[model samples]
Target: MNKHCCNDMTYHANFKCDIHKDLFECPDKLIFFHERDNDYGLIIHDGGSSSIEILFCPWCGKKL
Candidate 1:
């Protein structure tokens, strides 16, 4: 796993199960955090460029 910081940081993940295997298998949701202050932001799965749909977190799996 790798971490990157910028104006903002986003979480990325991928999934592959007996379910939605037709998905991008990439980050369905991203939890952006500012290491500078430990401030966190939530980005709900909206099905867009920065959209998230899966319930898995490659960063920190937490009921997303």
Candidate 2:
């Protein structure tokens, strides 16, 4: 398996750090998001436990 380093790949798959460079606090489940109705906020569900993280959220709370 080829695990990429945090400093290697950009959050939004970019060649370099852009908007989320300095302020990019990349979480384990951080990913891109695109939706309708502007469904903001989050929903907390039971996702078990882990040493890393088990939560999921849209990038920047759907800000992306």
Candidate 3:
């Protein structure tokens, strides 16, 4: 398996930083939300333990 190291932390994928990169065991059980200054908050929810992809950077809370 391939892994990347950042901030002395090793992860299976890109680990830019704590705020930017992370691994969640039950990602599907969590609801991700993004809010902008004027725009309505964007919410993401997986139906189950299925894989999900996000386009925004969770670290900076910016669109990717």
With a 3 Å backbone cut-off (N, CA, C), the pairs that clash in candidate 3 are none
Residue 52 CA error for candidate 1 (Å)?
A: 15
Candidate 3 structure quality by residue, lDDT tens digits, 1-64? 5121132212223223344233233332232322232121223333332334555444345543
Between the candidate structures 1 and 3, which one is better when assessed by lDDT?
Answer: 1
Put down candidate 1 lDDT per residue, 17-42, tens digits, no spaces. Answer: 35544332324435543356544444
Best by lDDT: 1
Off by over 4 Å in 2: 1-27, 30-34, 48-64
User: What are the lDDT scores of the predictions, listed in order?
Assistant: 0.39, 0.28, 0.31
Task: State TM-scores per candidate.
Answer: 0.26, 0.19, 0.24
Give the Å shift of residue 37 in candidate 3.
Answer: 29
Q: Which candidate, 1 or 2, has the higher TM-score? A: 1
Off by over 4 Å in 3: 1-12, 15-50
For candidate 2, lDDT tens digit of each residue in 11-63?
43333334434312333323222224222222122342222221332332221
- In model 2, pairs of residues that clash are none
Ranking by TM-score: 1, 3, 2
